[model samples]
Target: MLRDIDPILSPDLLHALRAMGHGDEIVIADANFPAEGLGPRCIRADGSSASDMLRAALSVLPLDTFVPDPAHSMAVVDDPDAIPEAVADFQRIIDDTADHPARIAPLERFAFYERAASAFAVIQTGERRLYGNIILKKGVIAP
Candidate 1:
């Protein structure tokens, strides 16, 4: 086991994160997401919940600051303004990882799928709850 890595980050997940350039996106998705048919690559944190997996990923990867909406979550159906409890959990996780609160964009279902399709990779989690998916953009570390 690597001393510094999150145990959930298998070699493939590390490779995907390493391959990503600044601003490339990754999604830590709910169990119900179609992770298999998505992304050029997929990694399974088979026993972990999406939010837990997301928290682990954030322990390593940095969020992109080049874009305004570096984080994204699915919007409540038919109520774009409503924040799901799962999304609120995501906000808190990001806020703690970042220095301040993250301004996450609530994407419509289809928009979220589009973003997922283009992501560098998708980390599919075991979370069974609805609206548990989250997207993160990769950021650079200053040299």
Candidate 2:
């Protein structure tokens, strides 16, 4: 038990977050996401929702402020304008955690998949919410 560390964050998750460099991305994905084949390394939180896992990650990981879009979520299929309820909750979670209203950019399914595959690692959560997948770029903690 480390001081102030969320128990939800396992050694693997903490290691991945610490090992990631500025601008390196990580994905917190839903159960439906193909995370096994998506990331070079994967951390599984089979019973947790993507938002829950993401909140836990944000508690420890800093979001890259250097980039215009440090956060991304999968867009509703066949409708770019369609925002899923899960995404709404995701935005709320991010807003509450990050305390910023930076818009969550919507990505096409294929683009999201490609991005996730290239991320440092993907955490697969058990979230049953549709379009719960989200990606975050790591940032520097200014001294």
Candidate 3:
């Protein structure tokens, strides 16, 4: 086991994260998310909460500062303003980990799926919360 690495990060997830370059995006999806159908490389993190996986990912993954919003969550269907409990947890996780806490941009259901399709990879979690899916854009480590 690697010291300081979040144990929740499986070898596949770590490889995907390492393979991704700056500006590339990764999706952390809920159980309900149609991850396989979306077409990006998929990693199964079943039996784990999206929040847990998200935190683990944030531990190693740097957020894209070049973009105004590096974090994004799917908007509640028919109620874009309503934030899911999971999304709130995501916001807190991002705020705690990022050097500059970026707001979680809300995307409509279809739009979110469209974006996920182009992500470098999708980490599907067992989280049952509605709107638990979030996308994170990778950033470079400063020299």
- Model 3: weakest 10-residue lDDT segment is 93-102
Per-model clash counts, in order, read 0, 0, 0
Better of 2 and 3 by lDDT: 3
Model 3 reaches what TM-score against the true structure?
0.97
Give all candidates' CA lDDT scores.
0.85, 0.87, 0.93
Q: How much is the lDDT of residue 120 in candidate 2? A: 95
Per-residue lDDT of candidate 2, residues 76-128 (tens digit): 88899998988888788888887334678999999999989899999989999
> Over the stretch 81-143, how does candidate 3's per-residue lDDT look in tens digits?
999999999999988976667999999889988999999999999999888899999998999
Which residue ranges in model 3 land beyond 4 Å of their true spot?
A: none
Models 1 onward score TM values of: 0.93, 0.94, 0.97
CA lDDT, candidate 3, residue 138:
96
Instruction: State the lDDT of candidate 1 residue by residue for 7-47, as single tens digits.
Output: 88888888888889988999998889998897547888879
From the highest TM-score down, the ranking of the candidates is 3, 2, 1
Which pairs clash in model 2? none
Worst 10 residues of 2 by lDDT: 94-103
